[model samples]
Target: MEGEHSHKPADIKARLAAGPKASYLRDWVYGGIDGTVTTFAVVAGAIGAEFSTQVLLVLGAANLFADGFSMAAANYTATRAEREDYRRLLEQERRHIRFFPDGERQEIRQIFQNKGFQGEELETLVSLITERKDVWIDTMLAEEYGRSNTQSDPVRSAGATFAAFGLCGALPLAPFVLSIPEAPSAATGLTALVFFAIGSVRSRFSTRSWLRCGLETFAIGLTAAGVAFLAGDLLTRLF
Candidate 1:
């Protein structure tokens, strides 16, 4: 049974016009998980080294801003590189279409023919696709180069990463900042919660169950903290 008016011509036309939206889910999740893990790792290390609350706060704060900004900048550069590459490829395709329409049309024909179109049907499909320059270029980008139509804004992607990193990273430093007793334990607990929360939120974009995602992220975070703690403890003993 059809639900609502989803199958209506008007609805289909509107949806197609809107096209696919660029997603920043990966940026947010990447920044959030790394922030929690790295901050907690710092906390664990400081605690193992028998550092004072003031020292822990100083270290955690430094890591939060420095690392977050670094990650954001790197993401921005990478996204800009992708956009540049797409533009270069787009221009290249446009030139090829302009200078060599026959070869381009043949490429289109071969592409669809490989997909099981045959004879008059394949010719019809090629004709339909090649009639419009925009559609023709889009088809070539998607089928030949595996490019996505939606282009994500580098600024937005970087902003999302930095925001998530700062927000989640702050959790592990909160207790020490506020001068709470048992600050290390508080930091650990808060960081653990953030890890699980980030993972659960990420599951909205994936097929995985929230529980599995949460537990997976929680384990990875704790493991990183554990390693840092061990290293700090060893160094303190050795020195």
Candidate 2:
């Protein structure tokens, strides 16, 4: 299979030793998309209002840092909360196993029984699983609470978000900072490119083709920027 690895014993042993790879793809994609969309929205609005280049640069830069940090901090807090929640549940499971071993065993048996294990097989399976305290607790956590075996690193997750946000967000302000000719159009073009690029990167984790993902993200970002531009134009005309 395309994504499958060799099932040879040695290969399996090495793979297991390496452990599960933690993915920060979601954090990066979230940050990248938001950064491009929001920064470009600011640019579009400023352009619609006929703001000076200096004003556009100021606003765009402010959004890049302020919004990026806010997003990173939020991500950190959320990831940490999830870890804490997992730990709390883990301890609770430990306590349950300690004080109510028989009940916990019944839970394990019922859980597997629902999966169709019966007779000696179920008894043997439960015995094998319960022999190890860590495995026993983990199985209960996974079966009862649907918790993942791997937890994310909050600091790493937040770092990924902040880095992606800053990198993608900077694209919109590039033209202005460089004093490019027709900087507004340049900013729009560049920001659109960033949106498409982010989507292309995102497609690696999905079933969709890169081009389709890129176009989809491009359209969404363009729509958001268009709305911002129109809003600014409407407000300008009214006031």
Candidate 3:
């Protein structure tokens, strides 16, 4: 029984460590979608307003840089804060164990009991977990607080978020470069086609059926573009 329990933590640790790469990818992709959607809407609105190409370019560039950096900074700060909070909680748990061993032990038993453990089995499990200081801290973190000791580098996450967002945001503005003197309609059509394709590709990451996800994303992009267009038209009328 002890051996069986001993093996479980290792399995849990392994499971926890695995798949973070894919998780990171999904985060990056989703963040990119957010950035892209907003920028696309802004650019579309500007185009609909019949703003000078120069003004549109400036707005798009500003949106890309500002939104990307802002998102990255926000992510960095949030992740760092969460890590600090986790550390504080862990230290508090350690102090409780040190100063009130009996109380803490009883709390651990209660935690296990809440999970439906009872009798000698619960006692054995609590004893096993609380015997080691690290394990004890981990158990409290998991059971009492629902926290994990997983370390995520805020700087890395922020950088990835920025890069993903910037790359995606740049896609919608690509048409502006070609809008030169000869063909604005062609440029707009091309931009719409490209954005739709991107929406479809992004949909593959979600759990929804590909067709459904693709359509939803496509509609969202179109709706954003249409709103911007209408807003631009209204502004043109008003001012």
Candidate 4:
């Protein structure tokens, strides 16, 4: 039982047992990291360019709304595209099974045979699965095509992505918007925290250490900000 591999903590165990649904947090991490990075990039760039707080506010706010919505729209379209691809493949499988029953059966048998099943067991499995239309199509879809039932909900995914983007993206602009002193520094700190939080939250769906994940995300975001800031500074000096 110790090495059985299914064992997990009580709270997270149920979710993990459920498969890819738990992995939907990918959208959350994706949106959060980008939102913070882009917004902070603007803030850092404005500062490095010796731009006024007003300019920082304007740029950051503009990025937060425009870029956030764009990313969400892209996510929605991409998710829908994936679903459509799956449907297309499933339909193809259906037609294949209908038109060429023997060939389809052979395909199933060959698949299982390659997996080490043969003779009685192989025939039994092939017969059992192919006996039902849905089972047969699903088996081909999964085994042959590597598809799964855990299709992402486009609406939910887009909502999660945009919500995370909006919240995390607001960090860099918060200081300037709120008239905080040392606005640039405040924005940097806030964005860093957001980055760490996004990484930490991502760990919930992965086996990675919370601290390590948090630091990795922080490093990526800060590095991007640093580059943007340096570019702005270089451009400012040149022009």
> Candidate 4 lDDT, tens digit per residue, 121-186?
999999999999999998999999899867998888888899989998997898898898887778
C-alpha lDDT of residue 130 in model 2: 94
TM-score of 4: 0.87
Q: How good is model 2 by TM-score?
A: 0.90
**Residues 195-236, model 3: lDDT tens digits:** 566556766565566667666766766676667667766877
Quality of model 3 by C-alpha lDDT? 0.75
1-239 in candidate 1: lDDT tens per residue? 42234878998999888887899999998899888878887887787778888888889899989999999999999999999999999999999999999999999999998999999999999999999999999999999999976899999999999999999999989988888898777887998898888878877767899999999988887787677768777887898
* Higher-scoring candidate on TM-score, 2 or 3: 2
TM-score of each: 0.90, 0.90, 0.76, 0.87
Tell me the alpha-carbon RMSD of every candidate: 2.6, 2.1, 6.0, 4.0
With candidate 2 superimposed using the best TM-score fit, by how many Å does residue 94's alpha carbon deviate from the native? 0.1
lDDT of 2 by residue, 1-239 (tens): 78669999999999999999889999998899888888888887787788898898899889989999999999999999999999999999999999999999999999999999999999999999999999999999999999877999999999999999999988988988999998888988998898899889888888999999999988887787777778777887888
Q: Candidate 1: lDDT of 169? A: 90
Candidate 4 regions with alpha-carbon error over 4 angstroms: 1-23
Indicate the residue-level lDDT of 155 in model 2.
93
User: Model 1 compared with the native: what TM-score?
Assistant: 0.90
- Note the residue pairs that clash in candidate 2: none
Error of 4 at 195 (Å): 1.3
